[model samples]
Target chain A: MDDATRVEVAASLLEAYRTRQPIEPLVEKYAGLELDDAYAIQQHQVQAWLGEGRVIQGHKVGLTSGAMQRQMGVDQPDYGVLRDDMFYPEDAPVPAGIFLAPRIEPEIAFVLSRDLTGPGVTVAEAAAAVDFVLPALEIIDSRIRDWKITILDTIADNASSGGVMLGSTPTRLSDVDLRLAGCNLYGNGALVATGAGGAVLGSPLLSLAWLANTVGRHGVTLRAGHVVLPGSVTPAQPVRPGDTWTAQFAGIGSVTARFGQETA
Target chain B: MAAHEAGHLLDPGATVGPIDLRTAYAVQAEGLALRLAAGERLVGWKIGYTSAAMRAQMRVDAPNFGPLTDRMLLAGGEPVSTALTQPRVEPEILLILGDDLPGGSDRDRVAHAVGEARGALEVVDSVWRDYRFRLEDNTADGSSAAHAVIGPLLPAGVDLAEVGVTLIGPDGERSEATGAAAFGHPLDALGWLADALAAQGSRLRAGDIVLTGGLTAAVPLPSGARIRADFAGAGEVSVRREAAVPPSRTPADTAETGT
Candidate 1:
């Protein structure tokens, strides 16, 4: 896969993802054509997004959950970049068509003030890198058409990222247990899911370590001012127009997002 | 395609929304309730908390499981078009049981009357609007399983012992580190799944399609590309996507050499 070919493939993948189409097996097929070409396509695509002024806001670690790792047949988790433009204010109504396919989930989002990376990054070191913690709702949407994709395709698709919603309130990392913080989800006034910060790899900070080391091993470093959606505090739920969702954290408080027409 | 078509059990007329609830687990429960409300059958459950690394990554101590309906299964070696749902490609080992492994099944006796094992792909799609999701959200998002693309069945001849097979990527780079990437072997993973299911009073039947997690790391397939996987003796399976229109200003990813 030449650079042009890589870019073409990546562009097509992003388009396919946006339209809910399938592209992983196809991307893998191209993988056999060239290694450098394949990676070039991935980097090129993400960099293009960055170039477009989509501030890289946070990072998402897929297959971070043990169950996901087994199901995907990988030992470690894979990651994708997150951008600031994708962030939604908690309780804001979702604009229609902002994502190829969107779903709602309760997650712990960490605000990092310092850069962290290494071949020897530890959980303790990760904890020190954080600036604050907040309740977050991940509006997960995939660019794939039918939601059918392989893990590698997802990695290239930026982990099926769409947008995130953060609670208005922010708490310092030292103010909460981080791991012991609890979360509960409510949909349309009904309690739907419940979990703790520990559910996301024990602590959102540890998840940061995983991302820092994982990406660092690949020669990528996590920059400061980036937010990390460690993982879902609970399983994800599907959303529709006119639906109101809220995620409540035991200590950190909660955030809410509404959904409606594309412009809403 | 296989006998089943993979799709969201959500009714076409049903309303969708962001499960503003606290956790994705709630969303999953809500979805399951909706499925029950719509009279969709719960075929079986998928296990997500199967890897220690993943469990550690998400800060959990055990694996998690989700329900798989008869609707979620696709034919073996199905060619997924590019215009369908957002799809991710992952190679897996599928298990067909010869007997029902009821709840409380012992790990040692899990090998009894196993029918066949085959390489498979799990096509995961998030029901969210813009493919944005978290691990917990997706996990509760029915493990992000909108459908599945399974492949030709490998006979029971190949067990865990022959798992030293090579995984050749699209770039012609061969990697032999596929061992235990999904818990050593497909059957071993299946065994764990069966035992786990048994504990929930759900048993593996003679015809249940159990996707034994990923065989190799997830590979990205671009439009106009095809993926081919050749097992030592288990045979090979492939899939291709039609050309996709380029995305506006795509990213650049360059892969280097070695290993």
Candidate 2:
């Protein structure tokens, strides 16, 4: 409950994140506290950053793949908040130095035109709220060093969400069969991954439904213009300096970006 | 016996070719990881891709499962090696069966056989070349589960039957879901899972650990990102994400479909 202590912890964590240093010891320093208490303190830290002018841009789902579930030993996936400072143009060069730990994942991004709410929101209903769908990439970065962390560490780090690369195509949701949409994930010009739209819980729309009900339980609403990167079409791959990754959706166009070496 | 059989769903990854659930190229991928553990051994297993969300995410409709190696297991207060994995941390409740309940929609029997409950986090990592894999590729590969860091175990008396759990992110953004989120009461789903496994010629033994499914949505954890899930009195589990070098490329890379 010490504001200074929390800020100190948050600041220290952010530094580690920027350098990709380990944060296990730091997190353990605060372990044993109530889950709610731990989160409240962290929320304050992030909100403070937001108050300084960073806008909350979107959210991310990690461990959405089956491989992640088995590897991690948990059943479901996890989520993180996205901020405007984290987004770059589809072709932006990601400075690797800012991410303590970083990876690149190919994904499909959907922008909602209307607020999506539901205990009863159906896939059809969730899809109806979409404004445009873009082929995108999520740059995942964590504040923990050595690339090691737990749910608590990730939660405190905002779910390891770093930045997003948006495509320009802007396909209409109603015009496409998201379930059938497929993407070719290319690294350095070679196809490295391929997945159908169905890879994300049947369709990316299902991710929206899951988010709607999930956030609804937390008393939050899915506002319009919010972009949801349903889940990684391909498992995330490590990005070294100078690595370029791109995702081409069958009919939705594509998004691309490059990574620079960590400088900090 | 196919472990706890829930209603059988199709794991679309099966479309590429035959997948040896116990042994295959995918298992080998996991095997390489196991070898990386130095002296770790098999501990338990988990079911993945059970929900429609997962199926669609992978463009598959069935659930996938993976083994939990000994090195991956953790109890409350246990120290973790942050160097172990390129991790994604997730919260879930592990359901240990008391009596073998048939897998189907048999809620009553499922409710009765709940032996023990605990909150745990699944620590996952991507292992394919460049860390890119399709939904089916992940599904059949046991969902690329790297480890299962379990928390303090709880006795079977815990009435997790219908409790609400919250999923908090590293930055403290919060979300909540009920036990019902896993198709409602994963224990009930366990019955069906058990039955499904039995039908497939397998059965979940007493010592087996069945990850009921995720309670909240999936969130990302960077390498070194730590995470946990507090299941009220059910105890909490922790995990750390680690960085991994890309594996050597293979022909599967050439045979990849739908790209």
Please report how far candidate 2 places residue A152 from its true position, in Å.
2.4
Every model's DockQ: 0.02, 0.02
lDDT of 2 by residue, B86-174 (tens): 34555667776676555563677676666677777676554433234555456444566755666656544644433434455666544
Best by lDDT: 2
TM-score: model 1 vs. ground truth:
0.48
- Candidate 2: TM-score? 0.49
lDDT by residue for model 1 (B1-259), tens:
1101353333212333344324555657678777777776766555553443334443444545566676666664455544344555555555667677665555656667466666655655545333454455555667655445566665445444233233334554332222244564455677777766665455677766666665434455556665655543355666555567665442333223222
Cα deviation at A229, candidate 2, in Å, is 1.3
TM-score of each candidate? 0.48, 0.49
lDDT, model 1: 0.62
